[model samples]
Target: MIQIVPIDTPTLGDRSYLVGDGTVAFVVDPQRDIDRVLDLAARHGLRITDVFETHIHNDYVTGGLALARATGAAYHVNAADPVSFDRTPIRDHDVVEVGERMRVRAVATPGHTFTHLSYVLETPDRAPVVFTGGSLLFGSTGRPDLLGPSHTDELVRAQYASAHRLTGGLPDDTEICPTHGFGSFCSATQSEAERSTIGREKQVNPVLTQDEESYVEQLLAGLDAFPAYYAHMGPANTAGPAAVDLAEPRTADPAELRARIDAGEWVVDLRSRTAFAAGHLAGSLNFGLDGSFATYLGWLIPWGTPVSLLGDTPEQVAEAQRELVRIGIDRIESSATGEPEAWSGAAPLGTFPRASFTDLAAVRHHRAVTVLDVRRDSEWAGKHVDGAVHVPLHDLLHRLDEVPRGEVWVHCKSGYRASIGASVLAAAGHRVVVIDDQFDQAENAGLPMTA
Candidate 1:
């Protein structure tokens, strides 16, 4: 009997799979935390004998090499990639055997990355499952623009060829399990389905239906701005990222934390947005350690900056660090759990002013405050406040100077990003009023809407 266990990292919205044939298995696209895969293997009485990566990932570090080293398993990557470490270089139609009857056939499907591949896992009682790393996603394919503008056309064309290659050769009932497109920024688009099949894709995926030129144009046009941290991932992976050290980080007391911050270090507060708003270290930034913590932290903080973590509990601090290391932000100088004010023996920062959509509606015409919509350009284009200043959260710091000189009110699709923006503004000495409410409230409250 063959068993396939999925290990999903929800924070980054990617899935890694463990395929076993009773006694042995191989892992596909494992994340930095290898323990999860180990636990799955342990439960099933399967020893992981091999590991595979579809591509050098853009969003997080890969656990392939590290896992291989840990387990004495053969690690695989594309032969074309100039990787620094030792790995089995796989090519089109290459076959790998992990168990008595379980095998994986590598299919060269370069699109998302120049060195991408899709693997077909063959086992006892299933047709087959194709692990489409970033090349082929649910309905949409991975974005070709990740490599850079110069490489986009070349990659997009390759994406077109790769899509056909998978759909044409594979059986219609073949399971399509992709690693991207599940809310990760890596996908060009998203699909609602929990699982996909080759037949369903042939009937629905536009690349299979449209002309190459049309498909390329559509894919390119739909491309969204990715996080700034993405640039570091490709290089980090190619150079062979180190295995994550998942120890509960050494706890630091208040004085050590305060001294580190005083010497020009970053202190990230990973508390609830409400908790952060209530009280946090004066110079510390609130990333909330939720939904999009990894992306926003990597995007907003200067690269290579050593950071310390502060949270309400040890569990929260550990969770925040786990997410941070995935994006190559492992230069953690210290970590601690406590009230923000107690961390430094100084009073925590004051809570910024907040107002609801209805309250802000009455004051919309006031020349005293500017309503800043910090959503993406697409969101802003579809609808936003009539007289609001537009600046996407990712670009806010660089363009902060462009904001008008006055008190500012900030909001995103929800309260999450608004809290982040509000913190940044407050830290910068600008007066900020957080409109910590849902965007839908804006329309019902009779606020101005512009499309």
Candidate 2:
């Protein structure tokens, strides 16, 4: 009996699979942190024999090369990919046996990337399972535009063909284990379903249900901005990423923290949005641990900028470090784990007002305040508060000059991005009030909205 274990990195919305039939195992799409994989294999009493990557990833750094080297396992990647590191270049239709119970066959599924391959794992007693990396997702396919707009049309059409190719050969009950679409921006759309099969996807997935032209049109229209840091992931993965260092960073004193902030380096606070809004070190930005910490930080921060961390606990700092390393932000210049007072030194902690859409509506009745909407372009185009200044959170730092100087009320679809935006504004010496409420409440609050 083969046991397949999904090692989920929920923070990034990706899953790495570990499959074994008691004695030997293989891994697929492992994250930068390979200790989790090592520990899992140890616990399962299985020796890893192979590591596979479906494509050169563009979201987070790949752990395949490092893991394969560590365990002396054969590292499998697409033969045609222009990677710098040594790898077992497996081509389409190639089959490799893993122990006595399992065999994996490479199937070309070139929608996410031109070289993308989905692996079909077969066992004697059970239905086959396909590890669809960025190819076929649960309800949607991987976004085809990640390689830039030039290849989007070509890839979308290929993506459509790939979905059909997989279903054409596989049984209806073939389990679908995908690498993206949990919450990863790599997916064309987010999916709520936890588990699915080829049969289920045939009944619902856009790539499977719609004609190629229709699917292509809808997919191209729906893509919003992916993380800016994605520009660096592919190159790093192709060159072979180093083993991540999860060690707690060197501790910085309050004065050092202030120095880093004054030098225009990012000093991130990994607390809850509410806690950060209530009191935080002045000039420090909030990309709270409670939300998509790595995603937003990676998206917003100027690439290659020095970063320092302020968390309430060592564990928080450690978690933040793990998240940062996955995105190739390896060096955390320093970190401090303590309260706002301690990090504030002799200075007072800064704070901002947090209110709901009802309060915003009421304020609009009497006075003028800069209403800033920091959602993505698609979101802003769909519906937005009337008379709101639009600036997607990713572009906020560079476009700060466009933000009119005044009492600014910042908001996003949810309050999370709003708090981060508010912190950015407050750090720039603008008076900011975070609209700490859902955007859906705007209608109930009688705030006028425009499409």
Candidate 3:
């Protein structure tokens, strides 16, 4: 009997699977969290024999090579543009044996990227299961526009043919598993249901409903703004990820934390920005403990840096620690164990004042405040508060000098980014106020607008 284990890619909300028969296992599209897969293998007393990358991912880094390196397992990818790091290059019809009862056959599926492929898992008693990387999603399909214009048409045509190959050629009952799910940038249209059957998708998926051209047109129409950081992620994945060292859980006194920070160690405040802005130790960088925390941390902090975590509670600290470990960032020295007591010994960095739209209006009338909008440029263009400076959150770190130090008012669509911006400015000794709400209220009130 074969068992399928689904592991959630916390950052991207994507799913990577581990397939095994209680003796040897195979992992598919292993994300940056290689430890979890290892742990799962250990729990089942199974040895991981293969690590496969269905396609090069853009949203989060892939951990296929890392897992293979750690476990001495073989890493697999398409023969064309074969993954560079000590991997077995697999081509169409290439067979990889897992155990006596299971085998995986590579099937070429190009559309999302120039060299995409899927795996068909053959089991003893059941129909084959297709691991459709980005080719065919639950409700929609992978976008063809990701590949550069030179090969866009060819790739799109290949994608359509690939979809037909799987749906028409494979058994109707073949289980379909995808790399991405709803809310992923990879798939233009994704169903809320993460996994489905080929027959079910053929019957209900709109993209599969139409011919190639119509599908491609619809995909191009609804793409959200891909984050600037995503451009760096894909290439890094192709090259293989650097090893991350996890810090052991140690109870640190406030003096120890301060000494470490004073010694040039990086401190990551893992609480929500709002909580961090409420009151935090001076000089801690704010990246909320929400989605993409590990990804941004990897970018911001150098590998093997002696880092400390500050969370809202003990539970939150543990959660943050586990997330960091998933991405191989294990070098956490210690976490602040208690709240006010934990912070009382440390110097107050500064406070980010909370403001409502009414407060913002009052400040605007005074002419003494500098309003900073930290939402995206497109969001700023949609509408904005009068006399507010446009500085998107991602760029705020680099453009801090552009914001005036006196009486800074930071805001975003809601209060989230504003809170992060406020925390950053406060750490820099700027008097900051984070407007928690009242954007819509202020708009309804017909407050003045500048640009």
Q: Best candidate per TM-score, number? A: 2
Off by more than 4 A, model 2: none
TM-score of 2: 0.99
lDDT agreement with native, every candidate: 0.86, 0.95, 0.76
Q: Using Cα atoms with residue i matched to residue i, what is each candidate's TM-score against the true structure?
A: 0.96, 0.99, 0.79
Query: What local lDDT score does residue 359 receive in model 1, on the 0 to 100 scale?
Result: 76
Question: In angstroms, how far off is 249's CA in candidate 2?
Answer: 0.7
Record all residue pairs in model 3 with backbone atoms less than 3 Å apart, i.e. clashing. Answer: 244-328, 245-330, 245-331, 246-330, 246-331, 247-330, 247-331, 247-332
Q: Stretches of candidate 1 above 4 Å error? A: 253-256, 365-367
Model 3 lDDT-worst window of ten: 221-230
Best-to-worst order by lDDT is: 2, 1, 3
lDDT of 2 by residue, 217-302 (tens): 99998888999999999999989998988887999998999999999999999999889988999999999999999999999999
- Model 3: per-residue Cα lDDT at residue 169: 72
- Tell how far residue 33 is off in model 1, in angstroms: 1.1
Tens digit of lDDT per residue, candidate 3, span 159-226?
Answer: 88888887887888999988876566667665778568998988987667888788767666655444
For each predicted model, how many residue pairs clash, with residues at least 3 apart or on different chains? Answer: 0, 0, 8
Candidate 1's clash total is: 0
